[model samples]
Target chain A: MRVLGVDPGLTRCGVGVVEGVAGRPLTMVGVGVVRTPADAELGQRLVAIERGIEAWLDEHRPEFVAVERVFSQHNVRTVMGTAQASAVAMLCAARRGIPVALHTPSEVKAAVTGSGRADKAQVGAMVTRLLRLAEPPKPADAADALALAICHIWRAPAQNRLQQAVAQHALKGPIR
Target chain B: MRVLGVDPGLTRCGVGVVEGVAGRPLTMVGVGVVRTPADAELGQRLVAIERGIEAWLDEHRPEFVAVERVFSQHNVRTVMGTAQASAVAMLCAARRGIPVALHTPSEVKAAVTGSGRADKAQVGAMVTRLLRLAEPPKPADAADALALAICHIWRAPAQNRLQQAVAQHALKGPIR
Candidate 1:
């Protein structure tokens, strides 16, 4: 399964593509960050993100798009930007019929490093080792994006099945 | 100046259009809520919002889009949804080359009512009076949407000039 992971942010959105099933070794197809100017208006920044994510989708054509689920952090303003960027990523994928999955920061860390509490350096080191790359992806955000894809790929088979069932049910009609 | 105001929400996105400029009687061109299933996936709901906003833009062809600015509050989850929805609204407007403006809830209240701390009912009543409506728009969100348009229209003329200068500078290139 080819999956694209996105660590969404306004200043630097990280994107990475990983290809392979859960059991087999995964191949890193690409890794990069989409950066927008800090001083730009909020609306223009979002439009830039949409264009960036759309370009990635057009190039990689991943079967699934994995995005880091945003949570309320102490920095409310920063969190709002993250939430907005993530929305753009998901919208781009969903528009093209690509399945989108959301994984928490801790979940991505646990998937790469043994512990959910692992720090960024540890997660980056493990990602480098797992992907057999000469060095870790730069900007930390890029590494986190790859981790999100790894987490989605490593998720239990049963969980994926349940998610598929939910997606199918959603298509049937509105639950309300 | 024709303005389309959006009160962005995942479940019920309120949209209203007002035509005319400051110091003149404003006309209510349209008002309604875009409802999406509560149980839908986040990406799907965003897509629905984009479609709804697009339809409104097509029908009204407002020169400016005014959206309520999202601020963090006690409810983290709800605030994230609001931020995301606002992002989508802004994106739709920006993509079409229509200028988008953001008005805080307090600003909207102050523009229509004498006080910024006015309650929803008070704001609604004032909106009805300002627009010469027979009754307050249904659903508090719809009224709030109109208030946003009114607020944008009533912003100090100097501020609009400053904003236009900044927007023009942004088009030149990345400030950073």
Candidate 2:
């Protein structure tokens, strides 16, 4: 599957597109960041985010989008910004009629590092080694995004089975 | 200014494109809902959102995009869906180089009802009265979006002044 992974943030958003299936090394398609000036108005920053996502969508055309699910954080402002940024990404995928999956930070870390609590550096190193790349992906955000996609790949079987069961149940028609 | 207001949701997103300034009745240029099947995968839902936003952007070319900010909710799934929908709208604005403003529920309610605690029906009534529409905007979501644009207009003066003050302060250099 072609997966587009996203690390959503207010000032900078990391995006990575990769293609591969389980038990195989993923191929990197594209990776980049969308940046907004810290001093810009909220509205302006949101516009910058939107533009970046659209450009990425138009260029890469990934079949699936995977994003990190936001857990509760101490800073309300930061959480709000993160939520908004993530929302923008989800919307982008929706517009393209692609599927979107969300994984927790720990899940991604575990998928990339062998340990759920693995640190960033370790995860980055593992991603590079697993992908057989000479160098790790640039910027921490990019690596995190790639990890998210990897996590989705690892968890795809259970997700697919659940979806199939649900579809079958719905197809049975209304209960009397 | 032409402002596009969006009420982001999973099943149906209400959008309104209006043109006007503070203290003046805004003209409704266009209004509609972007919808997706509940049974659709998250990715497909996102694609629907993107197409809907793109269509609106193309039709109206609004200079500003106003969206209702997401708040904490009891349902994690609902919140996730809402966040994804909001992201699509934000990206749509950014791709076009248009500014986006996010308004809190309270802020919009206050703008339309003089009380931040006002309920949806009251806000809808005010939107009808303020815009001189023959009837209130259907589906509280659409009216709420219109209210958000009105809130932005009301708050623009203070925001502009703040921006100018910051600009002037930067010019003055470091304090002794």
Q: Model 2 segments beyond 4 Å from truth?
A: A1-4, A17-21, A24-34, A41-64, A72-75, A87-99, A132-138, A157-176, B19-21, B24-30, B73-77, B155-176
Which candidate wins on DockQ?
Answer: 1
lDDT of each: 0.88, 0.77
State the TM-score for model 2: 0.72
- The regions of model 1 sitting more than 4 angstroms off are A159-176, B161-176
- Model 1 steric clash pairs: none
Against the true structure, candidate 1 reaches a TM-score of 0.92
In candidate 1 chain B, what residue range of length 10 has the lowest lDDT sum?
B167-176
Write model 2 residue lDDT over B1-176, tens digit each, in one string: 77788999979898987788777767778777888899977667777788888999998887667888887543655765776688778766655556666788888888779999998889989988887899998888788777877777667666635644543443343211
* Candidate 1 local Cα displacement, residue B38, angstroms: 0.7
- CAPRI verdict (incorrect, acceptable, medium, high) for model 2: acceptable
- Candidate 2, chain B, TM-score (2 decimals): 0.86
lDDT of 1: 0.88
